[model samples]
Target: MLVHVRSDGVNAKYNEELATECLVWINQVTGGSVNTAGDMDNFYEVLKDGTLLCQLVNSIQSGIVKKVNNSKMAFKCMENINAFLEAARQLGVPAQETFQTVDLWERQNLNSVVICLQSLGRKAGNYGKPSIGPKEAEKNERVFSEEKLKAGQTIIGLQMGSNKGANQSGINFGNTRHM
Candidate 1:
């Protein structure tokens, strides 16, 4: 049977820890522009405008975000976020690892913002930049030979009822009835 589990939201404690870690990393990448040494508590508010995010992505890989909007106007700020995300994408950060503009702008899911930053950090090493958080995931794409593919097609998988000649010939289901 399938069951549905309700999720309230992200872990506040984990978000706090990750936000701190990302702040320190952003400071390191931005060369103290983020100020983790003193303003550690206001991680979200500090980055809510998306300027730091643009700076962070540019640090990871140069020339990605051509221009970061310094304006505090909401749409302009969201444009900064979009630029950062696009730069992260160019840096090979998967889209799934990034958050939407609303997630960061409206603070709907700060954890996702942290996650996206961590992803960008992980990808930093690819561009010979300083990195933080978990190491970036490696791509291990497998290629099969045509002969191997043909051989696989000829074989019946065990889950497909081969099971050493076992069969369900005698099985019976309940008779149809309106009870």
Candidate 2:
């Protein structure tokens, strides 16, 4: 049987000596050495220095293993439950027999949780793609043509002698609007 202990009380604030004693106690119980930082050098030159770093690193490594084992157990349990459900479906089992094997309400909740986890993973995967900033809408203003005249596209109603379009002559200075 796997021992499941809540980590609410185990934290880093414990004294280094006490933590080392706790590490020894845990290793004695769990058959795993709490020595993850055997290769790291101490800040000081003393050979047995940085005991706190060793304890913390070992504790972290053990915690990581425990976490991985817990997840694997959970996945195995889910897989077993699903397999039992599939076998029940195949054998045309009664509802009373399968109801005790798996709770449908809990299974529905687990399904929603799986969907949420999948969405989170998808969002994480999409985070690496480049983001495009908002683009402004282009205004539809008129564009003037810059083409050569080609003998037919000149402005209409203009004569050759520069007399202001065939009406005025010889510079009359009174009517400013007409000028």
Candidate 3:
């Protein structure tokens, strides 16, 4: 796959073909085609993974979908009925429990953690841009002053710096007197 590394440090890409395919897939999945690309790539990933759990988690973290609160519960309730969490609960035990477990999991699975965090839908702080302008353009015009030299005045290389012409010949001209 041809990937263009962006100049900026952020790891984001704009793949033309993938986007088009995603749009088509979205139309096929949803009974009615949606207006935006938000759910398109997600639905595609769900097909690849054979489940919608991951996408659902992403939506929750992104704040696109909010979780309903349990009024009686002391702890903050999860907004969405995450299938992955349900599956884990159904299983005999959960591997992750303590803060250490969560920290270790985050370190190992950075991408998944990012998706989960985004599902929370918290408003992030703004890092504003600075007011800076472009530098002034340099003048290419050359300035030269005449100087007196002996009869054996020598001229070397072309005045204009052409890479091709310089390589072919050692020097353009030998000895010369002012015209």
Task: Output the number of the lDDT-best candidate.
Answer: 1
**Per-residue CA lDDT of candidate 1, range 22-140, in tens?**
88888888786654522223765788788988888877767789998999998999999899888888887788998899877775667777888888888888878788877856889
Clashing pairs in 3: 60-119, 61-118, 61-119, 61-120, 62-118, 62-119, 67-79
- Candidate 2 runs further than 4 Å off: 1-72, 100-179
Worst 10 residues of 1 by lDDT: 1-10
- The TM-score of predicted model 2 comes to 0.17
Question: Which ten residues in a row are the worst by lDDT in model 2?
Answer: 38-47
Give the C-alpha miss distance for residue 159 in model 1, angstroms: 14
Give the residue spans of candidate 1 off by over 4 A. 1-14, 37-41, 137-179
Model 1 deviation from native, Cα RMSD in Å: 8.5
Q: How many Å off is the CA of 130 in candidate 2?
A: 62
Please say which candidate is ahead in TM-score: 1 or 3.
1
Please provide, for model 3 over 106-141, each residue's C-alpha lDDT reduced to its tens digit, 9 standing for 90 to 100.
122223322322222121111111111132235699
Q: Which order, best to worst by TM-score?
A: 1, 3, 2
lDDT of 1 at 1: 27
What Cα-based lDDT does every candidate model obtain?
Answer: 0.77, 0.31, 0.31
How far is 24's C-alpha from truth in model 1 (Å)?
0.6
True-vs-predicted CA distance for residue 44, candidate 2, Å: 52
Query: Which candidate, 1 or 3, has the higher lDDT?
Result: 1
lDDT of 1: 0.77
TM-score of each: 0.68, 0.17, 0.20
